[model samples]
Target: MRYGLTFLALSAALAALAVLAGGAALVLLWPAMSFGLVGAAYLARRPALLGKRPDGTQAAWALVLLGPYFLLTWATWRAERALGRADCANEVVPGLWVGRRPLGDELPAGVRLVVDMTAEFPAAAAVRRHPGYLCVPTLDGTGPEVERLRELIERLRGVDGVYLHCASGRGRSATLAIALLLERGLAADVDEVEAQLRQRRPGIQLNAAQRELLRRARARPGA
Candidate 1:
């Protein structure tokens, strides 16, 4: 019994370690590493679970632990699958999407939308006249445009998608858009989204930091 308990404890410890490592990796990779730690845990415990018939108490204990585990793992997978092609960081709020250039027509209903207005292709500036839309200064991830993005999100009802110019599709605007979506509720799969954007918009460009930020933003619950 003591040995069994020790083994269980060890598994839990290893799971914790995996979570840290996987979570760190996923912050920059998005869905790439979301389930890595959880998968590791299940693999670690599989041998023990198969070794004997779990009795009532042990079964109950297993239920307590595995129930939440399964739920989180399943949810993570669902999020990853659903958000595979979604652009933006991890913390984007509840709702948002990425649409084609000249975005207004393709936006989803009840979703707040924005687009780039700068001259730079693939990475540009926010439209100065547009009050509630998200835009950026350059593909390099600099400028004051980022500060006002939160205000824009706060003023909006629901975010559908942020549109981008075909040339400047993957710059600071994309990162900011992803951040706002995460602030609203989108998954941080910026990498996948960016990849798709590049394919769709051949000349689109994005710098490393903006790309990194897109994968790391965590969603703000109830925001």
Candidate 2:
């Protein structure tokens, strides 16, 4: 939050500079300021970040920067998609998979559940027909909401297919896949599972906080 706000203020200052200096300054700093706003929107995503507001009223506050935020994220998503070889989910376990936000009809045939772990953007069209769509709006680098971690771990089970995703299918979605593995006893060792995930999805990774989530999740009954 601190860094995001700093960038927001910095971007505003840069915009002011661009307007005042004009010409060369305007040309270079305008694009720089635009990028900074996008960074600000991504970093300070919490609903309460503004005046410690209520948990669910971020829309009105976020309207100001939605333009740049969507443009940058969508562009990044497209760049990643364009460079990738496949658009569909990559199965880690038989019933579980990880991938970027599904577009159009990219969800696998048996995917009965779609768990989205990103707060950046919405991509529900791919999962529109699936009834068990879950939105665990999470910050980019953070783990799932700890208060609901247990519930999320449970929800990942008993389904024929659970399709999990984030911005790049590398972190958040991969972390959920790790939770499913441990929660369901499909895998016990986090190291081994991570290694396996990397083999299937070469870019998959989990952060410190997300690794902590997997640690706590493994302490479940009979787990």
Candidate 3:
């Protein structure tokens, strides 16, 4: 409540200043500033609202600052579509997709299974509505959980159109995706998997620990 009031006060002050200054650029800039202030205040008060992904918030605020409120809505929809592509969540292969925490309704039609790799439950209530949702809680490391994940992936191979996700869809999600690729013999080795993932989803990165986990998973007896 306090933050909301502060944002209103700041926005009014800036808008008033813009009116008094009578400068065209300041008039244009004040709206963006006001939008940014609102985003900052809301995020400060509830950092977990967007979970681990700030890009969505950032993009929304940017659009709000640049145009009318209605236009902001349109931009948000477009941004979401772009996000799936930018994060390489749309489709890594013919029937496989990877992404961050996604709500059940946001999933593409005909997704037979969802493999959630987030360490904790997602904030979205709709995620629980998915019939094939499976949560595999795991931290960002090379632990026993990796083996468990491999086993689960192996068991789910027959299922088509699987969607795998983590909190940010960058590290853990990519790790599991690569692991699955190797396990299924889709790619020849770790380097091949990495090359393919990067080719499909540019800027996909993995940490040392995750890379090491993949290496160990690859070296296992029947891996």
- The 0-to-1 C-alpha lDDT of every candidate, in the order given, reads 0.39, 0.69, 0.61
lDDT at position 64, candidate 1: 41
Q: Rank the candidates by lDDT, best first.
A: 2, 3, 1
| Tens digit per residue, CA lDDT, model 2, 1-223 | 5546655776777778888989888864654555475555547555222211122223554444454555666798888889887545788878788998887578887887788776666655545445767777766666665546778877666777888888788888888787777667766688888998888888887777778877776675455
lDDT of 3: 0.61
User: Clashing residue pairs in candidate 3, if any?
Assistant: none
Question: Which residues of candidate 2, in runs, are more than 4 Å off?
Answer: 1-16, 19-64, 217-223
Off by over 4 Å in 3: 1-88, 120-123, 141-144, 221-223
Clashes of each: 31, 0, 0
Best candidate according to lDDT: 2
Q: What tens digits encode model 1's per-residue C-alpha lDDT throughout 32-75?
A: 23233324333342323311121101234334434444354346
Highest TM-score: which candidate? Answer: 2
Error of 1 at 209 (Å): 2.3
- Among all windows of 10 consecutive residues in model 2, the one with the lowest summed lDDT is 47-56
